[model samples]
Target chain A: MTAKKIHPGAPGLLFLALFLLLSLPISLRAGEALVSGQYLSAVGQDIKMQITVAGPAPGTLIVIQNLPIGTVIDTASPAFNQYDAGKGEVKWLLTHVSPGRYIVNLRLLSPLAPGGISGEIRYKNPANGRLINLPVRP
Target chain B: MDSEKPLAGGIPMVNIDGARIRRIREEKGLTQLYVATVVGVTTDTISRWENRRYPNIKKENALKLAEALEIQLADIIDHGPPTTPPTEAPSLLSGEPSKQEAPEPQPAGQEQAIPLEATAPPTAIRANHRLASRPVVLFGAFLLLTLSCLALFWWSTANDGENQVAAVRTLPAHATPGITFPVVIEVTTTSSRSFSLILKETLPPDCIPAQGKPQFVSQASDPPILKWIGKITGEHTVYCYLAKLRPEAKMDTVHQFTGGVTVRSDDNPSIPVSGTDSLQVSPFHWADSNSDGRIDDEELLSVYETYGGIEGLHFGKKLIEEIWASKGYRFNPETRSYEILQ
Candidate 1:
C-alpha cells in the first residue's frame, strides 16, 4: 500500500471548517442567555456563589439552586439586580444556609453566544466570611 | 438627497424613521447616553427627540445629535401631515355658534399664545370678585346701624326728668276725751319743697278748746307734733295739711288725727220735803249715784247736767273705806273692792 501525500493547505482548511461549525450555533442564538443553580450544605455553615455572564442583550436571568439542608433565604437583602425595561434580568439572594458541598448547573433560555456562560459556587464559613469553591459532580 | 423647501405658509416638517434609528443604534451597541454625550446634550433631550414631542428638539441640537448618532436627520423627526384632519374655522358673522360647532382652531403658527381677550371680558371673569366685595359693604352698613341705635338709646335715657315729690306718713294722738295717743308723723322728700301743718279742733257745746287753739310744734331734724285739749266728753277729729311750694308739681297731700274724752262737776241742791224733816231718804238708797263720798241723786243729776257727763265714775276713796269698815270688811287691792273679814 502506498501512503498518500498530505497537503498543508488541507489541514488548515479542515481546522477553519471546524471553527466555523462550532461558531454557527452561537451566532444563530442571538437572544438573551440565562445561567442559574443552587448550593447545598449541612447545618452550621453557609454557601455563596458569584455569577457572571455576557450576551448581546443588556440583561440575563440567573437562578441559584439546591440549597443546603438547613438553609434559609433572605428575600429582602440588597442583593438585587437593577431591572431595565429594555433588558430583562432577575437576581436573587440565598442566605443563612448550612454547611456542605453542592453541584450547581446552569442553563441559557435565550443564549446570545457560546463559551461566555460561567459561574462559581462556594461553601462559605458564615462566621469567618471565607470562601471555598465547590467542585461540580459528574 | 437635497432637502426639500417647505411650501409658503405651511408649517415646517421633519420626517422620522424611528425603527431605522433604533436598529442602527442596536447594531452599533451604543447606549442612548453615548449618543447624547457625543452630541453635547443630555439623554433626556435625545429621548424627547426620539419620542417626537411636539415642536421636537431645537433645530440646532437635533441636527448635531443626528450627526453624532450617525443617522439621517429625518430619522429623528416626524414630518408627515397630522394624523387627524384639521378643524374648520369659525365664521365671526354667524350667530353665536351652537355647542356642537367645532371650536375655532388656534392660530396655526401661534398655537402657544393664550388668547385671553377673546375668551371672556375681564368683568365676566371677575363675577366672583363682585360677590367678594358684598360682605365688606354689608359689614360696614351693619356697623353704622349699630352705632346709630346706641346713640339714640343714650339720648333717650339722658333726657328723663328727675323725681320731685315727697312721701308722707301719720301717727297717733293723746288718750283724752277728744285726744288720741302716739302723736307723731314723718315726711320725706327728694326735693327742697315747703310743707304746711294744720290742726283743727271740733268741740262739743258744753266744752271749748282748752286755750282757744291747738298747739303746733315743728322740727327741721324730726317730724312735727300737734296737741289739743277739750272740756267735754265727745269725739273730735284733728286734721293736718302738707302742701308743696311748687304748684306746677302736683305734690300736695292732707292727714288727720282723732280722739275723745269726758268731764264732770260736783253739785247737789234738788230734794223733796219730808213730814218731820227726816230728809225723805226713800230707803231705796242710790248706789254711788253722786260719784262722791255720799250717795246723792241730786248731785248725780247736777254733774250730768253740768260738765257734759261723767263717762263712768271714780267713787270717792273715803266713802268706800267707810262702807267697808261698817260691814266688818277688809280691803283687797287685787279685786279693787272690800270683802267681809273672815
Candidate 2:
C-alpha cells in the first residue's frame, strides 16, 4: 500500500489561522485603556501604592486616588500631581500620554493599613469624548 | 487655486489643500509648466500653489486652475483646515516672478484667454522630494509585511521576479462607521510599453464596495475582493474606489487592505501593494471631513456636495447635524451612538 505525503505544517497553519482569528478583535479594536493599582510592602508607617496606566497614544488621563479616613500622603513622584492632605485625596492629571506602561507612585503617611484605599483612571477620548473610568485593582 | 473668501467673525477663510493639489498634478501626469502655461502663471507660482505656500488664490484664477486640471472647482477645496490660526496667510493674487522661471514671449490667441508666463525650462519644477520620501520610507517598512502576505500564497504561486511595478495607496487618516471613504491606488511601472494588468484590492471584511473608477470587473468574492482590469500605460496610472464601512462595525479594530498588481506574465506576475494599508474604524462620522471628530458647517456642506446625490446611503446626517449644532458630544458605547452634549 502507498500513502500520500502530507504537508507537515498543515497543523501549524491551522494554529496560525486560529491565533490571528483570536487576535483580530484585539488588532482592529478602538482605543480602550485601563489603570490598575497595587499596594507594595510598607516600611514603618509609610505605605506605597503603585499605579499603572496602560493604553494607546495621545491619552489625557486623570487618575484619582481616595485614601482611607486618616491617610495622608507623604510625597508623590512627578511633583506636579495634586494631593490634598486634609481631604486624603490624590489626583494625577496626565496629558498626551504615549502608549506604554505609565507609573505613578504614591507614598502615604498613615497608621491605618491599605485595606480601604481606592482609585480610578479616567480618560476623555477626544474622538468621542467618551469618559473612560477604570478602577484600579490589587 | 481655491481662493479664500473672508468671512466676518463666525467662519474661517476657505483654504485649499496644497498637498492634495500636488497629488492631483502628479497623479494626472501634469507638469508645473503645463499647468502654469495653461493658467498663465510662472512655474514658481504653480509650485507654491502645490506646496501650501499659496493656500488662497483669486477665484478667477481658481476657476482657470480647475479648468486646467479638468476637475471641478469644489474638488480642489480643502474641506478641512486646522481650527487654530493659520500659520501663514495665503499669498493671494501674487504672481510675482521668482528667479526660478525665465521670461518667454506669450503666444497670441492661445486656447485660453489668460496671460502666459515663461514655461518652466524643460524641467518645470523639481519634485518635492520631502513629501515623496516619507511615503517611500513608509512603503519600505511595510514592504516586508506585504511580502509576507504574498508569501502566504507563494508556495504554489509564481512571485519570483524583479520588481518593476510599485504601488502606493492613499487612505483617509480615519474611517467612520456607515460612511463611504475614497481609496486611491497609485501604480507606477518602470516599463514603457503598455501591458495588460489585473489590479486586485482586498478590502476589510466589514467594508463593501460603493463605487469604482473604471468599475471593478469581478462581481463578487469572499473577503470583499475588488479587481480592476486595465492596461498599464505611461509611467503612472491611478485607480480609485469608495468603500463603505458597515454601520455596526466594531470600533478600535485594525482593518487591513492587501492587494497585488498581476501583470500578464508567466514568471513574475503579482507585486503586492506596499505602504500603510491598515485603518481603524471609529464612531466618528466620515462627514467630519477634516477628521477633527466634530462635524462643522463647512464639512457638512462638503459632505452634501461630495456624497449627497448617492442613493440608498444615509451618512448619519441628522446625528452629524446634532453634533455640529451641539457645543460638545460623546459616543455612548452601549447605544452605539453619539449623544449631543450641551
Question: Largest lDDT belongs to which candidate?
Answer: 2
Segments in model 2 whose C-alpha atoms lie over 4 Å from true places:
A1-138, B1-162, B286-291, B295-342
Reference-based lDDT, residue B38, model 1: 47
Native contact fraction of candidate 2?
0.00
- How would you encode candidate 2's per-residue C-alpha lDDT over B27-130 as one tens digit per residue? 77566755664565777777877766556555556666776676887888876653323433335534655434548778877756653333444333234445
B67-166, model 1: which lDDT tens digit per residue?
A: 6556767765546543221211222423443333558777677967776645888887678557876897799899999999998886554332122222
lDDT of 1 at B282: 15
lDDT of 1: 0.34
TM of each candidate vs. truth: 0.15, 0.31
Which predicted model would earn the best TM-score? 2
